[model samples]
Target: MLAYFGPRGTFTEQAARGFATPQQELVPFDTVPAALTATRRGETEAACVPVENSVEGAVPATMDALTEGEPLVAVAEAVLPVRFSVLRRPGGGPVRTVASHPHALAQVRHWLAEHLPDAEVVATTSTSAAARAVLNGDFDAAVSAPVAVRHYPLEVMATDVADVRDAKTRFLLFRRPGPLPEPTGHDRTSVVCTAADRVGALADLLAELALRGINLTRIESRPTKDRLGEYRFYIDLDGHAAEPRVGDALAGLHRHCQHIRFLGSYPKAEPGGVPAGNDAFVSAAGWVADIREGRGA
Candidate 1:
């Protein structure tokens, strides 16, 4: 079974639907931590949660939650288009008050301002929750996924509501540590680590990967929260961890960093690129092994 951060009709639900096979039963949790915690507790096989947004960068709640508590590893991921619609009761009055999650509200800020300048914006826990508010007559309209209309007795009043034309969000399905997925050649390996405090610490940390020809896809740092200057970095690299180049790069990182946590290696949502130097790395390692066995000059 699969669990998702939702009350249903969330973008997470949409992403989970796509990530799960037809046989996987999808369940919903109230919060990101709750969904992930379920996976940690073995209440469910896996949980789906949003990790990043094109318009919003990293989702702090997800980044921090993944790094904290019992360890969970992302097994698969999906990227969904950031599309929203304004929904209201079929014969409802003008949209005097609009409700949605803060992230959803931010995406349609300009659109709402242009179309309903007088409408008051209210924050809800989830977009589906916003639809429930409209159903309860607490708000006149809700900014929600297009799918919300199917779940609630609401009709779309405004369609394709977005300030940015083509925004997207990335979601990951996670489960407790176990055997990792095999390398698909085109895959992603993610980790969170803290640099050893020194001159050019971050630079040196990145160089560990670069020297091994591992392509860094994304990198972001969050405060350790334990101290003022301490930070933990969240990184995504091209290629699966099982790949020789990636494995070696991580070994180099292990020796170079203050701390590290493996967040699993999984297939990319839109796979294509393979890291450079895998063949060279494998060959070089073979040569070194040969020398150690006294088979080389």
Candidate 2:
């Protein structure tokens, strides 16, 4: 079974369904952490949760769950285009209040301000939850996915309400740690590194990858929660750990970092889709390996 942050009509459920075969079951949990925790406890085979959105950046709950407690390895990822609608009851009165997940509210902030400047906005656990609130007569309108309108007795007062038309969210499928996926050339490795409380420590950590010609795709620092000033870095880099140079960079980081957690390496989502292999990166990897083994100058 696959567990997702849902009540059946969430974008998370939509992402999870993409990976489910007819034989598999999809379960819904109230929160992102709840879904992931179900995977960690073996209640489900995998967890599908949103990790990042192009507009809102990182999802803190998902990040914290991955960074803390027993580790879960990311096995795959899905990118979904986000488009929200302003939904209301069929005969509802003027929208005095608007409700939605905080991220959803933020995505449509400009639209909301222009259309309903005085409407009081409230937060919910998920967009589907916001739809449920509208059903319960708690709010006159909700900013949610179009799917919510079909699921609940709500009408689309307005459609395509996101601040940006091309906004997208990246969701991850996580499972218990096992053999890492074989290198795909266009793969990404994620790790969490805790730096020592000293100057240049972050720069030094980054230099390990930079010196090896390994490219970092993304990096963000989250509070360690153990202390006020202490922080842990979440980094996404361009190559798989199995690659010689990438492996070398990670090993070098281990020596300087207080703790290093390998999240996983998986095929990166690309425009034309993940290629079987990149001839250029493959040849460069071979040259690097040869130099390391004293076979090249």
Candidate 3:
């Protein structure tokens, strides 16, 4: 079974369904952490949760859970093109109040401003929850995923209401940590780096990756929570950790940072892309393996 953040009609559920086989069951939890916790406790085979969005960046709650808890490994990822609909009850007088998950609201900020400038906006736990709120008469309308209309007694006043047409959210499939995935040539590795509070600390961390030609795909900072002014970086890089150059860059980063958490290395989202590292990286990896095995230097 796959556990997903949901009330049944959430984007997280959509992503989870894409990966599930016909016979596999999908269980919905109210929150992202709850779904992931199920995976950690072996209640589910995997958890599907949103990690980042193109417009909103990283999802803080998801990031915090991955950084703190009993170490879950991301096995795969799904990028979903998001399109939200403005939903209201049939014959609803007007949109006096708008409700939605904060991320969903943000994505349609401009649309809401231009269409219902004076409408009071409220946040909900999930987009589906927002629809439920509207159904319960807590609000007149909701900004929700297209699927939400089916689950709730809501009408689509407008479709594709996002300010940006190309907005996308990335969802990750997480499982218990195990052997690192084999290199796919086109892969991404995520890690968390906690650097000491000092001058050039952040720079030194980047320099280590730069020197080894590891291309960082994404980087975001989060509070370490131990104290104020102490932060850790969540970084995503182009190559798999199994690659020699990528492994070397991680080693260098480990020396410069206080703590390093290897999230996982998974296949990149793009299709038909060239594998990272090429022949040069492969040769170097082979040489290092040979030396470690005492076969040759």
Candidate 4:
């Protein structure tokens, strides 16, 4: 079974349906943590959830789950273009409140600011549940996917509700303790580490990878729990650990850094068929290339 973030009308559900094998059973959950926990508990062979968006930064809950001592491993990835619209009941009665999953609501806040200016933003457990709320007539409208509108038979009050066109979000496919199938060439390794608080400590660790000709892709600093001024840096690199340069860098990094965790090395997103004019896609590819080859001037 494959677990996904869903109640069916979510973008994650669409991602799982698009990338998964037809025979794979897609289990839906209210949160990425729940889906990831299900994978860790052996309830599902793999779990799919969004990690970041082109427009937004990282999904903190998803990152925490991956980094927080769980055996769940990121095994593959896919990107979906996010198109949001406002769904309402027929006859267009005045909307009282707007409902959606927190992330979905965040993604469309600018639209809400402009169009549904006075509508209250209330949190729902999932995007599909928001659609369900609107369907049940409690909410005047909801901000959700086109899939949700079709699934719940809601009317579209406005199309293209997100501020940016061709927005995209990244999804991770995870499983554990098995031989990963050979990649389709594009690949990435995600990791977490901490450096000594000394001034050059972070630079020294990064410099080692730079000298080894290994790319350092995405790096974000998340505060270490209960430790003031201490952080864990999450990094993504282009090549697999089997490569000499990458392996060497990890060895050197391990020596220089106080904490190092190799989350997983997995296949990267396949290039073709992704939507055009997406800033996030461009940003992700640049980061990937940097990690793969250290592409910096």
Task: Go through the candidates in order and give each one's C-alpha lDDT.
Answer: 0.86, 0.82, 0.83, 0.75
The sequence of per-residue lDDT tens digits that candidate 3 reaches over residues 22-91 is 9999998877789889999999988888888732233788888888888898878788788888898889
TM-scores for candidates 1 onward, in order: 0.90, 0.79, 0.80, 0.76
lDDT of 1 by residue, 1-297 (tens): 888888798888888888788899989887788898889999999998889872223378888899889999988988878989899988988889999989899989999989989999999978888999999999999999877887898988888888888788899989899999977777999999987455787888899988877788999977787656666889999988788888888998888777889998999998476845678888898999999999995
Candidate number that wins on lDDT, 1 or 2: 1
Clashes of 2: 0
Q: Where does candidate 4 stray beyond 4 Å?
A: 54-58, 90-98, 101-125, 156-159, 226-230, 270-297
- Candidate 2 residue lDDT tens string, 27-82: 98877789889999999999988888722233788888888889998877788888
Candidate 4 overall Cα lDDT vs. reference?
A: 0.75
Which has the greatest lDDT?
A: 1
Off by over 4 Å in 1: 54-58, 117-120, 227-229
Considering every candidate listed, which one attains the maximal TM-score?
A: 1
Give me the overall lDDT of model 3.
0.83
Residue 253 miss distance in model 1 (angstroms): 0.7
- In candidate 2, residue 212 scores what lDDT? 74
Error of 2 at 283 (Å): 9.0
Each candidate structure's count of clashing pairs: 0, 0, 2, 1
